[model samples]
Target: MDSGIICNNALITLIAIQNPVDRKAIERIKEMKNWQKKEFGQEIITLLRSL
Candidate 1:
């Protein structure tokens, strides 16, 4: 089930769990080296904030 977009498991897992973001998670996301991870993290945060 590829969406034809770069995948980020950390964000995927975070969203799958449907848990609120905490400072530790934010920091961990920031420390990720992959661009997809960072992008997904941002998207997740944005999505969460809009709710």
Candidate 2:
């Protein structure tokens, strides 16, 4: 799927985790522009895949 969808799913998973969610960070991510989200998501995906 596209980076945006992947990013959203990742965020959802993070929120579902037992650990405390960082509301401020989530809000910042949610406020990001579409292109920014796409780039950020793609980078994250790439980084994770490389690990």
Candidate 3:
């Protein structure tokens, strides 16, 4: 549960930092194959790096 909260908060922070419109990045992230296996930090890093 702790990790879940952390991941959720991290996502909110990440999105807000990105001006809230680049939410497409978040959607693209959801569509990525095998997304469930990624750590929250890893996923965020990958998305940011691609930006």
Name the candidate that leads on lDDT.
1
Q: What's the distance in Å from true for residue 47, model 3?
A: 21
lDDT (Cα, tens digit) per residue for candidate 3, span 1-51: 676544566655655475322335555544333443243435655666776
Alpha-carbon lDDT, every model: 0.56, 0.48, 0.49
| lDDT by residue (tens digit), candidate 2, 1-51 | 776654466664663342223333434555345665455545544544465
Candidate 1's residue-wise lDDT over 1-51, tens digit each?
775345456645755465446434555654344665555666766677776
Checking candidate 3 for backbone clashes, the offending pairs are none
Maximum-TM-score candidate: 1
Native-referenced Cα lDDT, model 3: 0.49
Better of 2 and 3 by TM-score: 2
Ranking by TM-score: 1, 2, 3
The TM-score values for the models, in the order shown, are 0.39, 0.30, 0.29
lDDT of 1 at 1: 71
* Best of the two (1, 3) by lDDT: 1
Give the clashing pairs for model 2. none
RMSD of 3: 9.8
Q: RMSD in angstroms, all models?
A: 4.5, 11.0, 9.8
